[model samples]
Target chain A: MTQASPEQLAAWIQRMAAQDERAFAEFYDATSASVFGLLVRILKDRTQAEEVAQEVYLQLWRKAGSFDPERGSPWSWVVVMARSRAIDATRSDRSYGSALSDLEARPTAQPLGNPTPRPDRAADLSEQRELVQGAMESLTEPQRETIQAAFFEGWSHREIAKRTGVPLGTVKGRVRGALATLENVLRPQLGEQSMGGD
Target chain B: MEADRFQELCEEFLLSGLEGEELRAFREELDRRGAEGGRILDRTMEAMGLLALSAPPVDPPPALRERLMAEVGAGTERRGESAEGSGAGSTPTGPSLVEDAPAEPASAGAARRDPSGPGHERPDIGHSRLDRPSPADAPYPWVRSILLAAAIVAAVVLGAWNVNLQSDLSERTAALEEAQQELEAVDTLRQELATLREDLGTIVSPTGSVISLTGTETRPDARARVFVDPQTGRALILAFDLPILTAESLYQLWAIRDGEPFSVGTFTATEEGPARLELDSLDPVAGADLLAVTIEPAPGQPAPTGEMVLISGQ
Candidate 1:
């Protein structure tokens, strides 16, 4: 994973807000891999990921001025934007139902595998990635699967219930429980997040 | 939507799972929350974003970058052209990202190519004329007159309809703006109410300790109170009459344990009202003997090196 620090990305975003093309390019170079990685995982198609990636960057460009540091780190903002757009793309597509069914048929796995390997980057996880992966691994199997379905597969609590024959309440419980566990474990590692502006 | 439902769906909303009617209702409620809703969203986004980091890294194709830059350049050129030609292409400053996306992604490119993409589609008048019988080919001389009369009437009716549509659109636009403003006000009130509720809980908790903080020698009038839960170390500070902070500076609260200081959080104060800072869990602070607030150049300071403005009594 590219090691662009939150501060560096935030600064780049600030410059991008000023319509600095160089800053935009540098920001893209530093973070595009992570953004693309998330998009591909959710969308499950490289072409579609690539297309959405363009839209994501375009959005980043146009909305750079609105990037509030008080809200989140630049990387998180980018990830959230990428994930939301990818999920929206999937939801809008007519083929999503069949894709969801196909995904449901497969055995659940941690860090779901991608068959098409891009030679441009190494497969090693970054330190942050390792930390997140460790926290994820710490979850109970059910909790992990429920969260993975929701986060990676874009399955809602109701969708997960319908697809896996799990009770709706149970699915919601697992998600909430899993999130609490992750937040507890990751809080110290993630550092203090300021919730309000000065 | 009920508050309970809002709380329940918050996680899903942060994960971007809610769709259709549910999504719309949640957004409506969120909009009504004003600033408070925004904070909830921000916090949730940060958490969800971290979880997304679990995704394995994959580098995008190099071509995507080239294509993106090209598109950006084209957009820039278009913006510049529009700016030069007319004032109609004003830059958008709002933070509405999702709504701004092209309604149909594939058709977006096609629409971009069409010069009249932003306007209503033409009625294909040329085609209609071609399909019509020419005046010279008319069986009856009065047929041409009737056709001409019909055309005039249609044009007049169409123009009237267009005027009505424009007037209705303007009214709707103004109404939407007013509703949005009202929603923002409601959101602000919601945020304050939430803070008040949390403060009340902390205050009424039987297990919490109230620590009084008084101004240091530098300024004798600053006063603040900290309600710390001894068991969980969750603390809330309500500072009153503290010096107003400059734009470049903030007040950082620190809990002294042994000889070292652990940062609780950073906040700003107003002379007019109380400023509140809440710490989720500060285990070290629960047992610590002292809590201090200091002015810092920025937030997230490792240790307080700036002037101490307020300190808890021994």
Candidate 2:
């Protein structure tokens, strides 16, 4: 609930950059667990997750300035960086073969049902998405199905094309059109913050 | 850029990860932006971020926090004098953090409330997929907190379900620990028990005398030493180094009170099995021959029909 302002967060990151022990401690406190949680999801190994989480933070400390609030939210950027590190690490392990096969075998096509979702992480389910269900409800059957297949399943255009018997171009085009419309239609009803994310 | 264009690229970008110059240019432009650029960037970022949201972050070992803080502090201190004013500036913001090798002189009370460690969120830095669990035995504090919670709940439930089992476990553990602490105590206690058993075997009467027995030709490998306290009219039988009977058969003992056999006792022995038997202190009526042992079928008959393996002195 005690959210940091963009400027305040930026300043904290800056102080961290300066070798201020407290600031570094503060930054680690703020971001390490979130980063660790993200890495564990990807890597699924405690040892590896810990290693990647550390590297992500060190990278963040080293390149804090590289983070611009204008270009992307720090949360999303951090998620991406952590994922990149995790994916790279995962690829090198012998288990990568099995992991990819596992992903292919079970193409998850929806937000996982968290029957007892931690209150802190409910915010992570896409802030704008509280109304996304409503927006998703508004979409035509075809558009909704196609969008879920691509977005949630991590399906490629070719895969979607094969599954739906639609051309690759159409599936790709429909996905793009659907996301734009969902945001536009939902923005009017959801308000900026709801759409903007907390 | 227009929302439509951004949305279009975002879809393509999410479907296939950004690569080479495409990703490079994107990172560069976003890093140089103001509020407008930030909004555009955030929208694109959010759109792409949705494609893969199930990623679980790793939990590192508990010790990682100390190591991470040290590294972060070092990096900042190295650049503080040079990067001042800007976020990564030269000056330390809240007094000079490079003042000492950490808050060493702090008191115990302070350490307890110390958000810097322990109750801290369990710092795990760089304990990524690259690290092996074999080398890193300590899991992150958050993970440990979860497991500890589970363990406590288990202890509570299991303790309620089986009080005897819990007590038994504790007793076994305590016994093992006690034995470890004082070997002589255990030894002395064992010796005392044996002596008591020997003394307790005697039964008193006013008549009869002592007798001894030796092994038969069939079992030279078997040996036994017996003593009959005639005044007490009780007998103690100690058998050692006895060979086990075949599966269907067992060893038995007898009292030849008269020349005629009196079915006394039935028993069994195993490889290296040792046994002590106490025959009832019969009121020594007038005459008794001696004691005898035989191997027999599991359900022993009232009289001796099996082969006599040993006959002590009569």
Candidate 3:
């Protein structure tokens, strides 16, 4: 879990765009766990998650040329793509209503249960988790819940309001407030330098 | 919109919650501000992406990497073959004049001595193979003329053959790509069919309880069934003869436990008249008394927010 500098990762991605197989292998090794973990949380079915994860990496290979460093870091690009795929899978499932109900049953404070971490990367991942967790602590319980539903559960403001019995305006307000607070707290600790490509 | 409103939309855009007119407006505003606004949006997206990393990382199965690499290798090989085939047609291949000519030094001296002599024609011959050679000193002039004519015809034929081969190779490459896409589609369908077969086997097992639900007064033609394995809490819904729903609405199933309704799943009927729905994770059948279906708004409601269309006889 020793992170590559953003510039180094960007260089690898550029090489991948040129169909460099070794560079792609390196990129996959660096980011697959993060992508897979996010998919498992979003999809909730390990088999489906694995399938989607495979598709995500395959897509990264084909669409590497479309990656723009000016837009975001390579890690951000891959994570966003993984999230989009997982969300699409959930939406297309006929049993998605059941998944939503199961999600509602969980406490909003912990939308997803902690996944079992790989022993080799546990220390680095734990440190990263704590940084986020500490930033999240600054929000009110309601704000945290709203942000969790929006981020992890992929709920729209209207859906969050309907599920939590909060007013739509209230849910929107909490989301806005929570995002501002998170950016303020996280920006200093996880500054722009580590991310690279402005 | 005001600056504050645009900023709020940026957050919503990052979360993918913005849509329709608001989404359009946000894009326009970003365009209005150009690079500065885009940079801000990119920064927000990067931060949000990092935030997602807070989730504990789970190791994917080692086999996935091997499978992906194998697929990528295959793709790369196909690309390499296409490139090589196309390269053969475009590659420059004639013998260089400087390498072939025996009187290079003399020609160089002659060109330097006379500003415009037979040297000018020699340069033209170098540029275009079709250009006639200078009638300087050769043993049999007519013999040389015939040889040059034959060489020109050979060059024309060779160039035409290369162009034709390039065209054929391009068409073959396109066909291969299309066939590859078709094979991928077939593979996807096979996987879906396998999953359905597995579900069917479980539903027909002796441990499974079959509950038939008939349509209510609202839609008497509709019918459905729930197959539940009490021990495993696995359930599947098979709906038939149901009316197609409008885009704004869908059919939802609810599991009733102690008079409280919990959503089991949602589905819409196809034109062919059947829909298969799998419950995410079923509650123990022993704890539930009935299963019911209702027509609710699209995305479904937390509770039954519409008319109950079908219910189990229980």
* TM-score ranking from best candidate downward: 1, 3, 2
Off by over 4 Å in 1: A93-127, A194-198, B1-4, B19-21, B28-34, B77-314
RMSD of 3: 19.3
In order, what are the TM-scores of chain A for the candidates? 0.79, 0.53, 0.76
Q: What share of the true interface contacts does each candidate keep?
A: 0.41, 0.28, 0.37
Best by lDDT: 1
DockQ of 2: 0.10
> Would you list the C-alpha lDDT of every candidate in the order shown?
0.67, 0.52, 0.65
Report the lDDT tens digits of candidate 2 across residue range B1-314. 32223334445444434433334444444344334333443454454443333233233566778877776665555545435644532233222233333332334234334366533333234447657655257657578778889999999998887998888899998988667547645543554455445435442223434454567887766667655676644555567766655434556666677577654444445343365554434432125566678876532444577888788662
For each candidate, the DockQ is 0.20, 0.10, 0.16
For residues A5-51, what per-residue lDDT tens digits would candidate 1 score against the true structure?
A: 66677789999887677898999988888888888989999999999
lDDT of 2 by residue, A1-198 (tens): 113333445567677555456766666665565566656665667787777777777766666655544343455556556655666674444332232222123212311111121122224333333445566765555667777665434455556766766544345545754554465455445433322332
Q: Which runs of model 3 end up more than 4 angstroms from their true locations?
A: A93-129, A192-198, B87-314
What is the TM-score of each candidate's chain B when compared with the real chain B?
Answer: 0.57, 0.34, 0.51
Q: How far is candidate 2 from the true structure (C-alpha RMSD, Å)?
A: 37.2
Candidate 2: stretches off by over 4 Å: A1-8, A90-156, A159-167, A170-198, B1-6, B18-42, B49-61, B77-314
Quote the lDDT for A147 in model 1: 88
